[model samples]
Target: MIFTGRGRTRFLDAVTDFETAVRERDGDRAQRAMQQIQRHFGDAEDDQLAQVGPRLAALLPEVPPGPRGMVAVLIGACVERGADAAVCAPYVFDGLAEALGVAGEFCERWAATGGGDFPAPDPDAADGDVLERVGQDAADGWFTLPQWEMASVAMLNRPAVRTALEPALRTGLLDALRAVQEASGHDFKCLRYALVVLDDEPLLALHRPTGTGYLLRMTGIGDNFQLHTLLADVLIGGGHVPGQAPSAQEAAVCRNAPGQVPTTGAFNLVTPGGEWVWNEGTPTDIPVVDDVRLLVLDPPPYKRGWPAGRFFPGMPGDLVLERVLGADETREWLERCAPPK
Candidate 1:
């Protein structure tokens, strides 16, 4: 490689282009710009990633409302999916709230979805459908549950999310995932996938046993999880061409021992750290020997949580997603990052 390095140059250039597109209020170009942002950020470290906030801060004041809206949709849409962007999330979001004039809505809007005394799920309330249970569990403060744990249980809970999917795609995909778990002799309907449902907002749909998530993006006010699910259905199969901008793909998580996983779809594999062991190809050809996590372009606010949709304070938990990662899991990762304790 050459000098001065890939450092800020690459990441900054992408951000600059994004700023330009947003200033122009060209939704289409802004959307396309996200691809490069995601790619460049993936190649960067904490230093390069750290610059995201300032640029976001500077850009919001320079743009008009139209551009600001583009900024909210595209910029938020891009960074929210990649773990690499974690360093810059606070600034990125702060700028977003400033642009939208909501006085930093991130904490105010999404707090309860994770866990809080604010609008806590009614413990004594009779059982809600699967989603209601999962979302409640996410914020129950009992144990750190996986993000969207209930979603797995609610997969077939259609109109729900399962039935809304193309029948062939859903059935075949589930069978393939089931085969992997079955081969490993651990069956709890363990399949975690993120669905990119487009609306004015960003939200994720999570599965229960065979659960799925929306990987939600936000854009509206006073909306709830139902709104998110509906949007996912609308975006389910429309513009997806597998490998393209504003794309969608199914990523299966292998937590326990992975067995003979049948390759039947476009396979994208990664380590928990996001190192790509495999890339774009067909279902029949993807050959993986070790464990890996999916490297997503639009990661999420945190690794664990239901991604339940956001809502106004004093509202309800219906819109919230369940925890995707559990407490014990968080502790394991945390302990690794700390010194011997």
Candidate 2:
């Protein structure tokens, strides 16, 4: 359900006011304008509202209450104004489950599966048996589905949103970007970003995707590859394609270290020596230090080797190492690294 160029333009143009309102701390106007945008986008569904309302009410008793109304509002807007099922379903389902007194674990599982209507759990079923069934199903590959693709806005024309932010399901490129941002004590959001992957197999190639100011693409040997391959592919893939993103050329080549070449499953801490490890192996297992003079500490698949340290062919390679550190250390580092405003 990609949005048309006009639709995308409308959204971006309309959102200017909303973003500015948020930035200006005009909560009243911002919230109202957001709601107006939702309605303008045709998100005011009475049935969805009705379904969500009672469900929320029923769960109020058992739950420790906080901002239930806020939850409802968010859910309502997501359903009415959301761009795709991937983006909206999780938010709506998670919210409703909280309001309906559903177990947190169950809700999470349901979101992962993109659940549909289901009968209530049988009271008589053994708890262990239920657990065993779910486990068996997972072991049998129930959870192993094809990697879903989020299409471009020019392709979105349906009632619901097509591509949305899935915080719970980030790709390798996202992880890499996050790592660098975390280590550098800078906001990744301040930079335009993108991820793209060129698959080993033709069918697995990442189709060009259009995004808002940033893009992240990934390719795999198909979905059946080991977890490491998928992660590495995504990171490398992102490095390959910067899309319409700003400073894309720099972001793409920044991570290519010499001996610390990026692999598919390496963990890099952008510290003094370019600390590297396999996330599946050990957190503290620093394999090589000073292997690469400079490191690109984007997110996941922080692989090994430091071959071509630059993305573009002619760029000079600076030996900048990026890493992920603990919260306290990160704060300390940020304080030291702070530049004059």
Best by TM-score: 1
Model 1 misplaced stretches (Cα beyond 4 Å): 1-8, 61-341
Compared with the true structure, all predictions reach lDDT values of: 0.33, 0.31
Each candidate's root-mean-square deviation in Å?
23.4, 18.9
lDDT string, candidate 1, 259-335, tens digits: 22222222223233334322222111212222211122222222221222222221121222223444454344333
- Can you give the lDDT of residue 138 in candidate 1? 28
Which segments of candidate 2 are over 4 A away from where they belong?
A: 1-92, 95-278, 281-341
By lDDT, who's the top model here?
1
Query: Local error of candidate 2 at 2, Å?
Result: 34
